[model samples]
Target: METVRPVETWLTDMDGVLVHEEDAIPGASDFIEALKASGKKFLVLTNNSIFTPRDLRARLLGSGIDVPEESIWTSALATADFLADQRPGGTAYVVGEAGMTTALHEIGYVMTERDPDYVVLGETRTYSFEAITKAIRLIEAGSRFIATNPDPSGPSPQGTLPATGSVAALISTATGRQPYYIGKPNPLMMRSALNRLEAHSETTVMIGDRMDTDIISGLEAGIRTVLVTTGSTRPDMIDTFPYRPTRVVDSVADLVELARAGSGEM
Candidate 1:
């Protein structure tokens, strides 16, 4: 194999690798600081499309992660990017929260209920029956279907709640039109992030917790992947996956030294 170059850009999953719920994982703050001080391009990625980057930044700050708004990327943003590329200035019937809507609006997409070009599905706390029904009808009436991510359920203080994938399934059953998902493990999300950063796969690293979504997507994108055990996938579960990440570690804390070394801080 050719010698792997030093990492010049980084793509990291936000929820599990950096913060879990409202709490920052240990050393997550230092990791972010290291990435910033390295002067290397990096993006914090998340599949949740409920909040805008600004909102996520505030939330991370509350958790003491201190991730900048510009360094954050979401499924909503990736979906919007895909749509904008597929059909510039298109019209869509959106069934999502501020994150999805804001991204679409920023991309010059018009959200409408009648005669739309696409029916875009995204994650939201509240999934209104009326909105879903409208999406089904619009899709049945010839509008294309699109979704942010394929996560079937999301965590809540109460419990697991049906997410975008579950709703997309319902709509697909009703309309017989499967949505084109734009998040991991689609690889499109990773490629889009790489493109956004103008980074090459040979010199980019992806740090994530999930072997299925994050690791798979990074692998597909040809980026080196690091599996951290701070989130969904435990260390013992790593061997269960057919494909493996380039490296595995206990947590972001374990990689802080590597990050610092990359920045010439050693």
Candidate 2:
């Protein structure tokens, strides 16, 4: 029998695993605290490119979770990292909020509309027709197309709202170009986070609510995956997916003990 390596690192999705909308899930704070006490590497991951890590940190704090600013990883950051590696000091025509723009700017990327190197799309509550049109024209004009994530819809107090993926689809229909997505299920996001933690997949576990995104990405990145039922994916929906998580539980509350055990705190 193969001996399973003990988990040393954690990558958890932000929305379903930690918070839902503006509310933090029960025991989310305890789980984070346990991880910090464990002195293990960890990051709170989110595909929402609307907010920077600082903004996210504050929001999480508002929800009673005390994650450090550096411990949060957003899809915008991953996209910026990818772009910096692909073309150092490149220019882009951006269609995103401050999170996306700030990330690119930090990577020495200049945002412009005149013959840019890439047309970068990210999550934005105010996705304008003008900005998307510009992106379409730029892509048609030989600029590379890239998006932060492929989530078609995002949560709202009212109902589902169109997200980056939905807008990308519109652009693809108009320009015949499929934007390269760099978020969950892409594996690039996972690899980037792992690199940030300097952690190996064999000793890392990804905790997420969505099997399609979190579980798939973790599997592709060669890490253990845990599915929680507090978010998009429920227990009954587990068998619908051909892939399976290493484990499944009711919510992060249930994993607080495992988190403690992983660090020998139990």
Candidate 3:
């Protein structure tokens, strides 16, 4: 077990940790404000690559959380950041939506529909057989493969539906080349969040609802992780999962209480 030290930063999940289906979670806003007031650095780390950072920031503000557009970090942003870092001027064959294209474009990437240097996959509602075929061809022609996240499904009013990871898997199957995933569970996004915080992994804690992404990223980075039950952290899977968080709290309120107790602030 990694010894708990003075926390300098926090990487938080947005969907289940901060809000649930557009409805902000109780204590989320206040807790965030508290973190800010305490001068603790944090970022809203989300896997929803469907929306760009500006859109997501607006959504969060609309939900009543004091989220800055600049403080928001999505899988799209992570992918864009990664691409920019790896190959700034590389041409990309994007199979996602406005978020993917716009982010890449802003990072000075050249976007094309054919014979690109990279094949980047994200949540695309307009999945066509033609697009998949094109991606396969590009991969075979030696295009670098990249994926936003590994989540198979996303929560919706109708129920779970295919996410970006599903499409990325399809491309991987076709090309026999594994993709570099940029979202939670992958340290890529966490590294981006740490950069945003001007902090390193060792002094930061990753708090999220899902163990697969949040806890896994923390483990990979050798940091503390906190699982919140109010989000996607399932009950039955805790003990069974290979990675375990340092603590689990029921809600943001509970998290504050727990933190206070640990720091003798209560």
Q: Go through the candidates in order and give each one's C-alpha lDDT.
A: 0.91, 0.93, 0.81
Q: Output the TM-score of candidate 1.
A: 0.97
Q: RMSD of candidate 1 to the true fold? A: 1.6
lDDT of 1 at 32: 90
Worst 10 residues of 2 by lDDT: 257-266
Task: Mark the regions of model 1 whose C-alpha exceeds 4 Å error after superposition.
Answer: 263-266
TM-score of each: 0.97, 0.98, 0.91
Ranking by TM-score: 2, 1, 3
In terms of lDDT, which candidate is stronger, 2 or 3?
A: 2
- Candidates 1 and 3, the one with greater TM-score: 1
Q: Sorted by lDDT, highest first, which candidate order results?
A: 2, 1, 3
Question: Which candidate's TM-score is highest?
Answer: 2
In model 2, the Cα lDDT at residue 173 comes to 98
Q: Pick the candidate with the highest lDDT.
A: 2
